[model samples]
Target: MRITLSDLNTKDLATLVQRTITTSDLGKYAVISNHPLLSELKKVYTEYDAVYTKSTYSGKGTDVASADRDRDVSFRALKNFLDGYRKMPSLSNYQFAEDLYQIFKLYDLSLDKMSYSSQTAQMKKLIEDLEKPENIQKLNALSLLPAFNEMKSKQDVFEQIFAEQAGANANLRNMKSASSIRKDLEKALRSYINFITVMKDVTGWELFYADINELVKAAKNSTVADHEKK
Candidate 1:
């Protein structure tokens, strides 16, 4: 369901933050923890609930004038509302984004250890299988391969081809020599690098958020918007 951040309770908001932290790669986490925008977000998240409660429930201090009290109340509400915006990207696409992140991590962390080149025939079969409508449908349903650019989608397709090919190969059913493994690893690495190269414009949280935002926007402008129009 489409949701705005203000729609979530403290518990839900915290879950979103936790999901982001847990799913992120080290590079992504660095951005979340260190970037000025995201650092401020973490701070606001830590204190916003308490501040919202105080602003809404507590009376003005005795020394405050009535006019100033109203102004202060307005300002607090506005600030709290703005803070909620931080949760929007997560609320919209955390689950799919997590899946995509997992796929990337599988390649990033484990790619080098793979052994697919040894079973060229089986690897080709596996790639063909992945190209089937059913497998492609599954990925499409998750909205993992956004058309941010043609190159991004192409990278996704090729990476999946490499991964599935490796996994499906009978010869690679067991581990291989480290030197033998390097062949498949290098292949995977090349695909991964190509994918990241296509995405060179952004990195870390910025890149992560862009993926979700683009997918969400596409959905909203399509069926979601159409439903609203009707």
Candidate 2:
């Protein structure tokens, strides 16, 4: 069956892109025997293979690296691959895939690289905050009410940011801005926002906290009632 872009999920798309690139690289390597660039390509491909093998053995197989370190390394390898391919005269103008593949592949890799970088930075902040005794105590004592309230506020902010940025991007695309050659970016970002919003709603902070509070209260009440009867 022919797989269209709309048919593939995020993971599937990522895998498709990685496979396309890897296959292209291998084909070029085969054709360009005794090429000086072969050594570097082999080294990079070896690293990619190692990462792929490790993830498979761990039963957490993913095409795009999910972990921060591995993701960074994979992206670097991809970039190196692209750069080397550009330098090869023989591979020039070799059509690997259609424009959709070109656009989405670049978008996927670039967006993921940025997203992972941001997430890594955020994790560092969270770790720093958690390491502080006072902050840890404060977090430990967090009640359902305050926690949910804060989460709700943050959710609103996140939604607003997404909307504004999306609108601006759409406008830019419509205006045919120099940087707006990739029209699919706007669509991708919109879809991403929808996905994130649905996820947040499904895993709402308020609802989870309320459920935990109800469970704790029921346990406490059961204990007290048993003691009174005794």
Best TM-score among the predictions, by candidate number: 1
Task: Please give the distance, in angstroms, between residue 223's alpha carbon in candidate 1 and its true position after superposition.
Answer: 17
lDDT of each: 0.39, 0.38
Candidate that would win on lDDT? 1
lDDT of 2 by residue, 1-230 (tens): 12234333333333433443354245433333443333443444333333332321222223223343443453344334444444555653322212212432433434334654464444334334333665334333432234323433443444445455556555533443322322243234234323333444453433432332343344445555655777
Q: Against the hidden reference, what TM-scores do the models get?
A: 0.22, 0.18
TM-score of 2: 0.18
Candidate 2, 17: how far from true, in Å? 60
